[model samples]
Target: MSRTLNLGILAHVDAGKTSLTERLLHTAGVIDELGSVDAGNTQTDSLALERQRGITIKSAVASFVVDDVVVNLIDTPGHPDFIAEVERVLDVLDGAVLVVSAVEGVQAQTRVLMRTLRRLEIPTVVFVNKMDRRGADGQRVARDVVEKLETDAPIYFGSAITGVGVDDLVAGVTSSLPSIDPVDGPLAGTVFKVERGRAGEKVALVRLFSGTVRVRDRVKIGDSAGKVTAIAVFEGGAAPRRATARAGQIAKLWGLDVRIGDTIGVAHRDRVRHFAPPTLETVVESHDRVALHAALEQLAEQDPLINLRLDGDDIVVSLYGEVQKEVLETTLALEYGVAVTFRETRTVRVERPQGVGEAVRFIGENPYAATIGLRVEPGPAVFRLEVELGSLPRAFFTATEEAVRGTLRADRVHDCTVTMTHSGYSSPVSVAGDFRGLAPIVLREALRRAGTATCEPMHRFRLEIPADVLTAVLAALSKVGGVPLTTTATVLEGFVPAARVHELRRRLPSLTRGEGVLESEFDHYA
Candidate 1:
């Protein structure tokens, strides 16, 4: 059996990471020539604005063979603005190549990425690119990388443009990095990317850990089920249009309504959301509200974090910050052709169930042909089925539970497990759509009975400052709703409102006389 390695190449902006990707592909005979970012001809940076800006925005995939193993190369965006896209792809990688610039050394985003990689324990190989350019200091840059990122891995210095030291890098990846031997087991695959085909069908880019998925196979995709109408394995041909996607392979599968971070077969791995969820919201208005809404629906399907919704007369979009806002506007105008304007941004408060409550609706009594009994209470599991699993058709159960979670997510609630207290359906009259449509109503009724406590989502923050300025830093943190939990010498740690983290980061420099360093990530709600 052939082995495979799902490798990711990640870096901060302008580190020649994309150039390194093009070089790797060309060296492996995957492409005829190196595609230039400046020429707008790179293989991975496909977006129009991405090409214009000479930076990657979307994660791209290509396969290359080395010895007996097939290496699946994932080119992720280097920009902080597209960190969501990058974050979505990180879990799919078996190993990663962290690209650092020889001249610029380790950057802010580079440190962030390095921390995440270390936290995840993803085996990483650091590559120092642009060694051929003037002002490039490989030794000093290597020291900086060690000092900043604190990684003990070997760093390869190479000029991506000149193809020098790249062969060594490839050798390091093949030898030092892990290549998993595919094992036999129940079908377990992860959906890493979801794209709309030309015919508007969802195309799932899946990384299969075990078992095989062939054409026309009915598969369970997390909470949903669908037939695999077509398959294109990434191992062979310029594009393998139809083939069986087997274990240890990546493939483009059609005929599935799935999302990124979804398990395609059995649960391969639980996708942990580490980044702070978007709580900043703004209103979008257009001349054609219907068209604008339709476009946003499509966009939101691709990125669930957007949290697009109807807020009375306005359409609200939840996002991270200004850069994401600009990207959304650009995507709307360029792809959907819907010109729009945004209203004042505001903090979106989240809620948690304060008490336990149950509500039940019978089949004949309910307007819909499905009966759903829901119990809302404070817990960890987001959605749990208390009743027998086979009480209803799997499709109906999936739909109802999916709807329950959707409604809760739309309402911006945290840490509440909704249980299916009871479920019933009319034999001939009932359908999955009926249960899906009724679920939200029953869930909301139970939530109302339980009541809730609105909370401001917070971030776990760590600040390093000079010992002399600790007092001043502590005072500054208090101004931004920061709760300092602990102090170790000059290091302060605590939780702050997620929305105000950026504000604290902005104020840290002034508070500590430019000697303050702060790092924060979403922690919990208070």
Candidate 2:
């Protein structure tokens, strides 16, 4: 039996997460000497931009042995812009190490990370980093953990730079993480990361949760299946050929065309979920238009949650915050050698039909020479097309259905995908040679007439402040279009427009004289 743990290290920006990773690998003898994030030579912050900025932009993977256990570590970026990166990692994580700064204490991102970890029910251990800093206080940080994060888990103090308290932290991880019980079932795993090799062959990093997989095993992903040309176990950011990987192991595989969040083995049982949608979007432009599109297309393959798409002639990229925007800009210039400009940013919005509606495109009027009728109604899921098995000519069925689903998935009115639970179509006349081309037009018209209610992304926020500043905070919230649902002497809870969230966050500290605490999460699109 192989003893492996898929552990993820998470922290706020500048919290010394990558430093801790370096220290861990060094202590385990995986690396001889420590590399500094400041020097851009750290083992995990592999990209040039990450090294130059001294901040991790993408999640990195490495392997080290700890007390006879093989730990595959994933170091996640601390900036909120790359949160989607963190969310994807959570899908494959067996346990997580939450690195909190001893000097800064529990910051906003720390609170958000804790909420997500608890919500996902992933067992966690808190590591208080930077104990040697000028203002570092382990006890104070621990207290902040309890008061701000509301977690009672065991805490370990460590400095990623000086290597103090690292041994104890590793020991705590070895003792605290729950061992995964291998199930006797067919092979199952989730593809958490995708990359393009130098030869342009697709590579993926997968976390197998059950059964066993081998180098030549045939794997199924969605409707696509391919033989595994190669398999390698990750070691200190490198992969060495491994004949087989069993349950609870993370492996890098080749010769597979799969995207992030895709499942392997029994699809229903192993499908990965839970990704926060992007809240903002910006139009990307470059001097060489074709190069810009090509670059974005490749990047979209790496991180699908970015939802890179073309709106009219503008290529729009979804983003989390300003930090993400900066990283994307830097990556294009540094990695792809294409300097690009982004238009003014806007909050992404979605919409749902207010009521049922229908539209018809007459056979003679339309260029396709086909009469297509569609009934659009509201529902929870994205699209469900109910067409009589033989309603259309045999050849046009697949194309027609694809058109319907494709149109439904496009940005209709609010730049959000229009979801329809039930849409039915029946055309009695037999149409030949792709007459279904007009179906999308009819569906798009129907959706427009159906009426839509715009929904802006909203954040549910909790604020703790001095009782004396209650009135001032209330006024600030109102000025920012915040609606409080509940309020007490020191605590406030309410929904605020995500676009205005940054404004409120900036004002809270000054309003409370750096004593106010604010924690927020995406509640819904309201």
Candidate 3:
């Protein structure tokens, strides 16, 4: 049996990543011929709109065997609009191939992808694609990649269309890239993505890192449990039921109602997510208000980061950018048959705890009949019980946890650690409801003491324009509250409110006579 290597192929728009995926599949003899992105016949670009637009909108998975390794190639969208999809796939990749255009040199999204890959420490191979194009400059682009990426990644030159240098890429995957060995340890996995069955049942896409999942086994699904009715392993596009899915394999498991980021059997070993959550929100309007919310809930099940909720009478959905907003509208209309319009989008302002804080409320002493003490600190996002688990009735503990989750669910600010430092009860007077009611108040007071700093979402931008338009661009930046971190002769890098990005994009063309190119990504809240 061949070992498995979960690999991700990533690139910016038109970087030829989909073409490279075709070449890799064909090289492995998975397909008889190559598929073109423009022709819309590529195996991976399966969505209708994807074919119409000639770009990938969803992450596609295909399998091939290369050098005793079952290479599970996950093709991710290069467009900045669908970056949330790419971020979801990144959590499961053992390694990645970052495709760069030899002609375009290094792009803004390329820099973003590389920066994230490096930060995650996922072993990467940079493929300098479009080597056969007119302005292809492999040597210069190689230097540029080195300077911009600051990566020691093994670089290969290739034209995905012409199939040159694919052999070297193949060799690099086995030699330079990393792979994990299967283990027979305890069952451990993570639900990275979720899909719906024909009957609308939840089908979970789980990456098993160890042990085995067989039919009818009641296994842990995050904090809940579910019986595995069936299991199917990925065979390129087809998913046929299998007896069991073992370690070091990806499987589609049925009969599990799960959400993204939920762990199966054991704790997930992957690091905390590196991608920022959506910072923009829009109010959705639909003729059938009832059907609209129900459909939105179904869509949210697949990508929970979209954050579907109701604001008074209007339904609101969170999104990453304008592109995501458009995609959400299209998916709802095409898949869910829920056609809707959206109001103006706005930034999602959030409050973050400024420092370590502790607050306690005791029965009789406070307005509540429960005693709960909590400590909040600026750290990794986690909820821990510093107090013994058995101290309170299981229901009271559960209620306390629910209170914490609800309070933090809408917080888009930086992560903070919550710890239950103390807990007590006056016997019958301390009902589960008492703790649940007091937990939030105590936590809020702790947050207040820690200092509530409201922050608006900000985008880190890089602007390149001609020197002649420097004054005009600088003046334009000032109007939008752009603060340049570094200003060069023609390049300006800075942070601006996300709401100003669209306005800046519109002004760039006239400001630089259509020569100015601006690239920005959500950096942080301030």
Candidate 4:
């Protein structure tokens, strides 16, 4: 049986992720030429802004056949601001290749990505890349992966430039990666990314998990069941061709109003899973106010994670991390002819009432009444609010739940649980919708209210510096807001005390002074 592998190239920003992607495509013979990230000539970073900035602003897909096996490579943005792009792509991938710079080992964003991968339970292979660079210690970096990432990730040391160990790495991936086991029989797929055609239409890049789809094959997407009129094959930086794609293959499908994170298939729409989109939000800065909305709208269509809004005078756009924010600014200036400015990023906060509350009713200008009797209290941080229809018609439960979720989204509480309950005719009941905003206050005053806060993400950093510079390192960490969790001493013959996992972060750069090694993981929130 022929198999298709959906793999992602992930790493920290400037870890040579785009460079490695170019090399892989060139080696695989997918491209006749190789593009350099520094030169801004890479196939994936084809946008004008990307070429000028020398970084990947969005996820790009390209396919190649190696040894009769078709490999679909998704090159994702390594910067944190584009993390929403990363998170959205991860859901459709069967596996990922985590590229780590041998010289830098692991950085802050790497820890965040690894934690996300673990949470998704995706199998991964770690690529210790850039062995060609001076001071590139693959073995030491491999050890750091084990200790800091807390993974037994089998390492494949290689140089993307020289192709050394590339073959071995390929063999390991082909042999160990898991095959897709689709629950919704035959030909279901999910849209990982989307972009607008130069002519102003939407183009969806989809990954098929099972079954087969051919050009001109009618397909439905998401709960809306929108039909796809055409299928286009994409080979990077070119117009798509009419083609048929099977399970595990990535194809560019046209003629559908499909959004990113939408699932496409024949009877497989219900089984498709959506990944968590980007959380950070920001606003666009432009020299001219007239072009700001148009630019922001175009960007939002390209990547849905960047939730765009007009919050008074500022044009607001949400981002996953700082890197994404920078890319947005660059793109606005270069692509849209707008000089964009951004506010400091704020974490997406969730609020719920602390105690029990009664039903609150609000009468708007219309005759309709908005009544909600919610008992707001803290539940598990990550539990799905499942809707259960008991005696009410199943259709009613589904409709009501959809309405509740829609309300939540419109109210700007995209990350909340809501369920429909119908045990012995409960009037088509709709449960939790963690609504935010002032309207919730009117509801809370009439009912009940409570609140709890969970910060974005924290990491545990470990630095291995010369024994003589330990104190200086520790002191530096204090300056950068590093909290010292723990310290340990290594009993070597002549070396200074080696710290284990816990310590301050600011100290590492000063302690190492270009000599010591530092590592960290996603530690729990404060």
Model 2: which ten-residue window has the lowest total lDDT?
415-424
In candidate 1, residue 222 scores what lDDT?
Answer: 79
lDDT string for model 1 (50-167, tens) is: 8887878778888889898899899988877577777888877889999999998887778889999999999999999999989999999999888889999779999999999999
TM-scores, in order shown?
Answer: 0.84, 0.92, 0.86, 0.74
Candidate 1 lDDT score relative to the true structure: 0.86
* Segments of candidate 4 deviating more than 4 angstroms: 111-121, 150-154, 178-184, 215-217, 234-240, 266-291, 309-315, 344-350, 362-526
Query: RMSD to the native, candidate 3?
Result: 3.8
Off by over 4 Å in 2: 181-184, 268-275, 385-387, 393-398, 412-436
Over 4 Å off, model 1: 132-137, 147-150, 180-187, 216-225, 235-237, 355-377, 381-406, 417-451, 466-468, 488-490, 509-515
Best by TM-score: 2
Clashes of each: 0, 0, 0, 26
Worst 10 residues of 1 by lDDT: 234-243
- Candidate closer to the true structure by TM-score (higher is better), 2 or 3: 2
Task: List clashing residue pairs in candidate 2.
Answer: none
Put down candidate 2 lDDT per residue, 1-526, tens digits, no spaces: 4477889999999999999999999998889989998788999888888888899888889998765577899999998888888988998888999999999989989988998899888999999999999999999899999987999878999799999999999998988987565566888898889987788888898888888888888988877898898888775446788898778878888988888888887663544545467888999988898988888888887888678877789899888888788888988887688999999899988777777777776656667656666666666544444555555455565566677766655563332233222222335454543345776787778877887788899998999899999999999999998999999999999999999998998888889999998877777887
In angstroms, the error of model 4 at 433 is 18
Error of 3 at 365 (Å): 14
lDDT of 4 by residue, 83-133 (tens): 667777887788888999999887767777787788778889999998989
Flag the better candidate by lDDT, 2 or 3: 3
Per-residue lDDT tens digits of candidate 3, residues 1-526? Answer: 5578899999999999999999998988989988888989998898887887888988888888776787888999998767878988888889999999999988888988999999988999999999999999999999989997888899999989888999999999888887767788899998877888889899998888889999999999767899999999875545678989888788999998898788899986754766767778999998988888898888787777778876567788887777777877888889878899999988888777889999998778887778899999888778899898788988998899888877776445357789999998877767888887899889888888887688888999999899888888999999999999999889999999988888999988988989888888788888
- How far residue 55's Cα lies from its native spot in candidate 4, in Å, is 1.9
Where in model 3 is the C-alpha error above 4 Å?
Answer: 235-238, 268-270, 352-394, 411-454, 464-469, 513-517
Q: Candidates sorted by lDDT, descending order?
A: 3, 1, 2, 4
